[model samples]
Target: MTIHVIDTGFFKLDGGAMFGVVPKSIWNKQNPADENNLCTWAMRCLLIEDGDRLILIDTGMGDKQDAKFFSYYDPHGDATLQSSIANAGFQPADITDVILTHLHFDHVGGAVHFSSDGSQLLPTFPNATYWSNEAHWDWAVNPNPREKASFLKENIYPIKESRQLKFISGDSPFANIDFIMVDGHTEQMMLPVIHYQDKKIIYAADLLPSSFHIPIPWVMSYDMRPLQSMTEKTNVLQNAVNEGHILFFEHDPIYQAALVEQTEKGIRIKERAALIEFL
Candidate 1:
């Protein structure tokens, strides 16, 4: 088995919202904000190759939204979903599975694209089975007002319309790949736990979005339940440290992956390195 880091691109978000109630004085030191108080973040995805199956975890925000919508986030980067996949020696058709961590636009937007002349939308991966959980699927389709803006129908409906959507019920069919269900960020967000190359590497998705977010208290304000986020983070971090798991960060601006150690104060980053080193 092999793993590749697919950097879809970077986008901006309000630093305050990303860091929750954590004071700007604290988080600002690590992730410095722009004049508008918005911080740039990477939309890094993961591509896993196990024999013939090329599984992609989390598609970044696609380029289907209008200029007005794009102005809000301002996604700008040299890499794109198609470009990154080709860089990894694969195409959209090569992806056998597309695991959506959740239905958030930034994560699942690249899963679908607009058709020619912009009349209809289509799945980006024409031959892949898009994976999402039933609980989260239901929650996203009928979203709460707080999260409704993030869950766009354009990014979702195409897969089911194409008859390739698969629900990860009971347990996932993919071997050595397990999920950690976290509801704090969004209802039933599935974080991939892959037993790869004799080591357990966690695709930390939004649960631990960036290396700066490793601290238990640095929860995102967007989370539906902040306290649940703290508890989930603590448990995951404890297990990560105890079991010696390398964390694969999705939105970290700089660090690709990191090792954490149990410090006197709490869990902290031990070393920051590329995913290839861990592999």
Candidate 2:
């Protein structure tokens, strides 16, 4: 099995929301914000090539939204989903499965795209079976007022409408990988832990967005249930440390993967490394 890091570019969001309850004075030292008070973050996606299946996890905020909508997030950077896939010597048509951890615009936006004529939005990976659990589907489609803005209907719906939406077996979402269900960040947010080439790698989807988020209290305020998130963080961290799992970070700007060590300071990141190192 081979894993590829797909760079979907970067976008800006308020640092305060990203790091809940954590003082800006501290987080700024980690990822500093711009003059407008928005901190830049990478929308890093992952593509897993396992035998005949080519599975992509999270699509990043897509480019179909209007300029006015984009002005708020300030999406920047040269990396794009298409280019990243091409670099891996594949095309959108070749993608067999798209596993969306959640329906947040940044994570699933790249799932859909505008038509060349700008008349309609369509699935970005037209040939792939898009995966989302039944619970998250309900939560996102009928989002709470707080999260409604993040779950854009245009980015979703089109996948189902295209007749490609599939539920990861309610029995178990993970086929070869283990599905770690985390709810503190969102309802039933699924993280995939794959046993690849002698190492176990967990796609640390927003549960641990960056290496800076390693500390226990550093949970994001945007989380619906911060306390639950804290508990989840502890569990995942301890397991990662004990099992020697490599965490595949989705939103970290510079670091793609890292391993955790139970440090004196309650589960600190051991090393920041690239994804290719594991392959």
Candidate 3:
């Protein structure tokens, strides 16, 4: 089995929103914001190859939104979802499974795209089964006002329309993969745990978006339940330290993955490096 880092690209987000209550005086040092206070973040996805399954963890924000929408979050970078997949020696048709962490635009946007003639929206991976939990699927589609903007219909509805969407429950069909459900970020956000050889790699999704967010209190403002986010993060971090799990960060602009250690200051990043280094 092998895994590849699929970097769709980078985009800007309000640093304050991303860091929640964490003061800019502190988070600025961690990520450093621009004049407009927007910080750059990567829409990093994961591609796993095991047996006949070519699994993609999350699809970054696609380029389907209009200029007005794009102006809000300046999405810029050379690496695109298609380019990155091709870089890993595969094409959209080669992906057999797409595990959507959640339906947030930045994470699921690339899962669908405009048809060649721009006549209709369609699934980006024409032959793949898109995985999303029933709970989260419902939460996104009938989104509360707070998260409605992030859960764009164009980024979601097409998969179900294509009849390729499946809800995950109990054990996954894929070998060496397990799902961890956390509700603090959104209802039933699924984090994929990949058991590779001797190590367990957790796709950190929005649960622990970046190494900087490893601290219990650095919850994002976007989360529906901030206090619950802290509690879930503590439990996940404890398990990560105890079991020597490597966290594959999804939104961290610089670091791809990290290992945590139980420090006197609570769990903290032991080292941050490229995902390949962990393998």
RMSD of each: 0.8, 1.2, 0.6
lDDT of 2 by residue, 1-279 (tens): 888899999999889988888899999999998898788899998888887899999999988888999999999999899999999999999999999999999999999998899888899888898988889998999999988888888998888899999887556544577788889999999998888868888898999999889998998877989999999989999999998889888989889999889866678888888987755
Q: Provide the overall lDDT of each model, using Cα atoms, as 2-decimal numbers.
A: 0.93, 0.89, 0.95
Clashes of each: 0, 1, 0
- What ordering of candidates by TM-score runs from best to worst? 3, 1, 2
Query: How much is the lDDT of residue 185 in candidate 2?
Result: 91
**Residue by residue across 1-279, what tens digits does model 3's lDDT show?**
999999999999999999999999999999999999999999999999999999999999999999999999999999999999999999999999999999999999999999999999999999999999899999999999988999999998999999999999887877899988999999999989999999999998999988899989999999999999999999889999999999999999999999999989999999999999998
lDDT (Cα, 0-100) at 92 in candidate 2: 97
lDDT of 1 by residue, 186-241 (tens): 99999999998679989999999999999899999989999999999999999989
The TM-score values for the models, in the order shown, are: 0.99, 0.97, 0.99
Error of 1 at 97 (Å): 0.5
Report the lDDT of model 1 for residue 148.
99
Superior candidate under TM-score, 2 versus 3: 3
lDDT score at residue 102, model 3, on the 0-100 scale? 96
What is the TM-score of candidate 2?
A: 0.97
